[model samples]
Target: MTKPAYIAITQHTKNSKPALVYVPTRKHAGLTALDLCAYSSVEGGVAPFLLGSEDEMDAFTRGVQDETLKNTLKCGVGYLHQGLSELDQELVTNLFLSGRIQVCVASSTMCWGRLLPVHLVVVMGTQYYDGRENARKDYRIADLLQMMGHANRPLQDNSGKCVILCHAPRKEYYKRFLYEAFPVESNLHHFLHDRMNAEVVAGVVENKQDAVDYLTWTFMYRRLTKNPNYYNLQGVSHRHLSDHLSELVETVLNDQVWADFR
Candidate 1:
């Protein structure tokens, strides 16, 4: 006998009158909401699905003078916000797990470890870079993996029915970049040295001077030896930071500043 696949049911009512399409790109995120209004204006009866936060909905509702959007589409559109408490998370998860809301527009963060039955997953620009001081950082592959799990589920009648919409330029996007940011998890070293570089080197930094020296040498290697090659280690640059390093810096800096003031 075959094991049953994951099936979700909820008390949330489905709006079968229309379909909901979630967009990930900021350029087109609002298109679904706007198009619904446009279609409603001409068609007269069919309502379009609108997905946004309450604040977003409010702003668009107030900004647009379109009668169909303001009245009809606005009523059809649903708002989803991350301001949910733990209790609210359970409620929303139940709604999703139970298949209550027909359409939802959400950030990728919402997909992390969430059990929701979604018909589609859309990915926008994966290359989100942050420039801070003299550093540049790329979005983590772990972060992308977390979002991609939105489409993964046990095989069922509708389990493989999910569709992933990506940008035209990103037709092979996932293949190229899904594992870019997660070098360790993505087994990048295996790809580079074919398991020759799989060995992990452990060291003990006995003192603050040792830690600082390691960082200084790493900085020099990255600047002089590696040249254009980008290397980020904790305390070397804000570009890449581990949780412990971030906390340690914050604690030390705050303590020193406070002590100096006193």
Candidate 2:
């Protein structure tokens, strides 16, 4: 078979509404945006937003010190990631949402509840680093679904497109995984200490029992409660509850001043 091009462009929208290309890492996202911009046409001009008039676009372009990013912006492609400043992020997001930018290349962090009416979502990979697992892992089906959900806007007449590009080895994996919907697993354990500290400091929970009560109201708690078998918890037993509480309390006590609590 003939080798394919490094980058491919597919058009789904007639008006060039914003589209997202999701890469696995910040570096990949930046490189992809630069590649796309460098390969694409000037007719697909960049969008720069300023509080004032069109002249501000020139000013904004001049202000960007990164020559690569500045040039990419001129080509109507922008990259977004946690590394970018809040102002830069907002500028890219606003321009994309307003249909001024044709494509926004971003890492998977962009998928978390930041709704952009993108006409297409090109997911470049099926794996990401999992800090909890201490290794890279394939994305769960639920996460892929959530990411794909960003492609389509309910208000739009035309349905959006989600394309996942993976190596041949993982092709069957994605097929099987995406064939059926998977329920999202709880991740509250990751945030237990932070939530506990905030609730205690805010006086929303006075005691351990109050903390448990507050947690029970969370979606994670409800999922655990409803599907105890799935979690292997064997029901919301006192032992399991205490184990969770102990973990949270230990984390908080280690990081915070106990005397300040009173």
TM-score of each: 0.38, 0.59
Measured over all alpha carbons after superposition, the RMSD of each candidate to the real structure, in angstroms, is: 14.6, 8.8
Per residue, candidate 1 scores C-alpha lDDT tens digits across 151-175 of 5445522432333344466557665
Instruction: After the best TM-score superposition of candidate 1, give how far the Cα of residue 176 lies from its true spot, in angstroms.
Output: 4.5
Local distance difference test scores for all models: 0.39, 0.68
Candidate 2 matches the true fold with a TM-score of 0.59
| Candidate with the greatest lDDT versus the true structure | 2
Clashes per candidate, residues 3 or more apart or on different chains: 3, 1
For residues 1-262, could you state the per-residue lDDT of candidate 2 as single tens digits? 0011123233454555566778878878778877775455432433321122345455656766556666666666777888877777777777677655577888887678467667677788779888787998887767788788878777774687777887799998788776866577887766777777788889998876786677767787768766776655654877886676555656565566654665
Candidate 1: where is the Cα deviation over 4 Å? 1-45, 48-81, 84-92, 127-139, 153-158, 161-170, 176-262
Which TM-score value belongs to model 1?
0.38
Error of 2 at 202 (Å): 25
